[model samples]
Target: MVPEERDGRDHGEERERPRRARRPAPESKRPAPANRRAPAETRRPATTARSAARSAARQLRDLTGHDPESVTSVERQRDGGWLIGVEVLETHRIPDSTDILAEYRVEVDDDGELVSYRRARRYYRGRSEERT
Candidate 1:
């Protein structure tokens, strides 16, 4: 067998191999630095009652498949969330007064995301309630 010569060194010589450069580990494999904290919800707060009402109504419509006709009431809850009353037309009739309407009580978080909702009441459009 013939001897192999590399860099003027015989095959029998003990030469150190050149080290290969290491690449940075992928982002997922690296541990997070101690100074970095997990991200918190950074959504903007719904400041005005009108905006909160709109948000609640939109969210209710998306969930229930009924478009809200009006915002009946808006109240701030003790937990900093909002309680919104929305009116939706459930059924149409020849006479507008005979149309069926439903009131939904929708609760939304401070960030305008709906957390819960329910049909609070239902009645005909022309029906009048006595407030005593």
Candidate 2:
């Protein structure tokens, strides 16, 4: 303690000064869990348009006994089913380049089960559908 000068601070008042509050410890910087699931709001359901399209393509190939050429469209129906349009080579000609093509509308359940299907249109491999 400094020698109290005649400036007159009573030594007893120095001991009465307010004590400072202790601060909390800082938060830990540990890494987050590796297996943490995505927030529910940000996650999408397992059944998606692409999967539905694949299911339709598989069903069409299996039913037609030929590999499907392409998936043209996929639509969700009001009945909770899916509607997919597929193109397939229906016939082979002497020249491999000349094949008959058919378009089918396939219906499937949400679980990817085949509900029904029908051929919507037919055309040659070299020609496109004529819009009327």
Worst 10 residues of 1 by lDDT: 38-47
In TM-score terms, candidate 2 sits at: 0.60
Cα lDDT tens digits for candidate 2, 32-84: 46888667555454457788889988977888796798998988886667899
Candidate 2 local Cα displacement, residue 73, angstroms? 0.8
- Model 1 / residue 15 / CA error / Å: 76
- The reply for model 2, stretches above 4 Å from the true place, is 1-46, 94-97, 130-132
- In candidate 1, how many Å is residue 94 off? 1.2
Q: Residue 62, candidate 2: how far off, in angstroms?
A: 1.6
All candidates: CA RMSD (Å): 12.1, 15.2
Put down candidate 1 lDDT per residue, 1-38, tens digits, no spaces: 99754686566768899999999999977877888855
